[model samples]
Target: MNIVGQLAPLAFGLAVIGSGIGVGIIVGKTIESVARQPELQGRLSSLMFLGIALTEALCFIAIAVAFIPFPKP
Candidate 1:
């Protein structure tokens, strides 16, 4: 009901949006790389998954942080 409460959700929304963009970029680049060199598809795919996992982890961390109770000023 206060400013902090309102901003917490907004921050989480931004985090989610960022994660989505990060994932899109990762996949798009990976596809481009694989298209250029079909033989490197295996390596490129693994790296892409790693990047996506790390990117999604940010969203999870944001969700956890948003639920933490902040001390009232």
Candidate 2:
């Protein structure tokens, strides 16, 4: 098997895992901030959603890459 064929799944998995971790951290911090300042919940929530969208985009990109054909050696 080609090297890229072997590694693509690993790369895709890592990308998704990393994205999940990033989103988790963002949500955890946003929740903590909201608890500390209820009045800022709206702003915090907006920021959190933006963060989640951006983080998830990485996983999508990784999936796209996984489907692409690897160059011939």
Candidate 3:
């Protein structure tokens, strides 16, 4: 296998790891905000979900890109 083939999986793994961290931070901050302002819980939760969806979408895109065939030099 060439460099691109070997690196694809590593790149996808990094993308997943980054997505997980992104999700964790989003939830943690959302919870902290809700704890401080109970009334804003509804809005904060919606925004949190939006952030998670966007982050996960990025992972999915990375997966798609990883599967694409790269031309040989």
Candidate 4:
């Protein structure tokens, strides 16, 4: 197998791990802020969802890349 074939699993793993870490951080911080200032809950929730959506976009890209046909040697 060539480079793309070799790296696909690694790339997919990194994509999933990175996205999970990102989401965890986003959620943790959002909870901390909301706890401290309950009045900002609405704005914080919206921002959290935006962050999640953007992070998940990377996952979708990774999935697409995984589906690309590998050239036959």
Query: Best lDDT goes to which candidate?
Result: 3
- Using alpha carbons, what is the TM-score of model 3? 0.90
- Candidate 1: segments with Cα more than 4 A from true spot: none
- Against the reference, the lDDT scores of all candidates come to 0.93, 0.92, 0.94, 0.91
How high is the lDDT of residue 1 in model 4? Answer: 35
TM-scores, in order shown? 0.90, 0.87, 0.90, 0.82
Clashing pairs in 4: none
Model 4 per-residue lDDT tens digits across residues 1-73: 3777788888889899999999999999999999999999999999999999999998879878887986686
| Higher-lDDT candidate of 2 and 3 | 3
Which is the better candidate, 1 or 2, if ranked by lDDT?
A: 1
Q: Candidate 2, residue 44: CA error in Å?
A: 0.7
Q: Pick by TM-score: which candidate is best?
A: 3
- At residue 8, give the lDDT of candidate 2: 84
Residue 28 miss distance in model 3 (angstroms): 0.5
By lDDT: ranked, best first = 3, 1, 2, 4
Ranking by TM-score: 3, 1, 2, 4
Q: Write model 1 residue lDDT over 1-73, tens digit each, in one string.
A: 5777888888899889999999999999999999999999999999999999999999899888888888887
